[model samples]
Target: MKLNLKQADTEIQPQWQPIVGYPCPPEFEPSTWVKLWQQPNPYSHDEALLLCQLTEDEWVAWIPDQGETVLYRYQFFQR
Candidate 1:
């Protein structure tokens, strides 16, 4: 969950904007974003395989036969 300081400076700051489409509420805080990034996956399968195409700030969570969900960190830079 490393953050790209350069990218962050370019994409965030000024208004502290996040990459669009992440599940961030209007009032969400930066600390909350960091917590989400640090959360461990409860799934047993290969997490890396599930995240192959995703950037560091991007993530995919498997929900078994229920399908998968693609997630991104709002206000976080891609590692």
Candidate 2:
């Protein structure tokens, strides 16, 4: 997955960071299945569709758990 370095710099860094390497994974294409590596809870088809529709900023603002804990951009992935 490609990361937006500028966006990352603007946000407060999360304690749990991913360790990505060379030959980075392909970008996320719009799909019915998506997953967050850190979280086991699966998103339903409708929810996944909604997620695909959201912009990066909108996704960041939308807390999947609806709690104060913030989710970083890199945590998102296609299942």
Candidate 3:
């Protein structure tokens, strides 16, 4: 995926905030970090929205800050 700052403007704030560097987990691949975005919920203290890339070979899954044990997997093709 590519980062289109111009296109992102319509969806997100125009400000660019640097993310603190953190070591990627050994289990995660470099592509896993591509074109990802996250936002915290203003109404809920522990809620967040995570957007990520999905591939045919692999699917994207997430466990919310407060949610059931089930893993919510999403396919990129669906989008």
Task: Using lDDT, give the best candidate's number.
Answer: 2
Candidate 3, lDDT over the whole model: 0.33
Give the runs in model 2 whose Cα sits over 4 Å from its true position: 1-22, 37-47, 50-72
Question: How far is 35's C-alpha from truth in model 2 (Å)?
Answer: 1.3
TM-score of every prediction relative to native: 0.23, 0.27, 0.17
Top model number, TM-score: 2
On TM-score, the stronger of 1 and 3 is 1
Q: Please give the clash total of every predicted structure, in order.
A: 0, 0, 0
Tens digit of lDDT per residue, candidate 1, span 1-79?
Answer: 9876664445543767677888764432222212234323554222222332266456564434334555565522322
RMSD of 1: 17.0
Ranking by lDDT: 2, 1, 3
lDDT of 2 by residue, 1-79 (tens): 9876664456666696557675656655443344554552444221232234355433422334542223345655555
Per-candidate local distance difference test = 0.41, 0.43, 0.33
**Which residue runs does candidate 3 get wrong by more than 4 Å?**
1-36, 43-59, 66-79
- Pick the winner on lDDT between candidates 1 and 3: 1
lDDT of 2 at 2: 88
lDDT of 3 at 56: 30
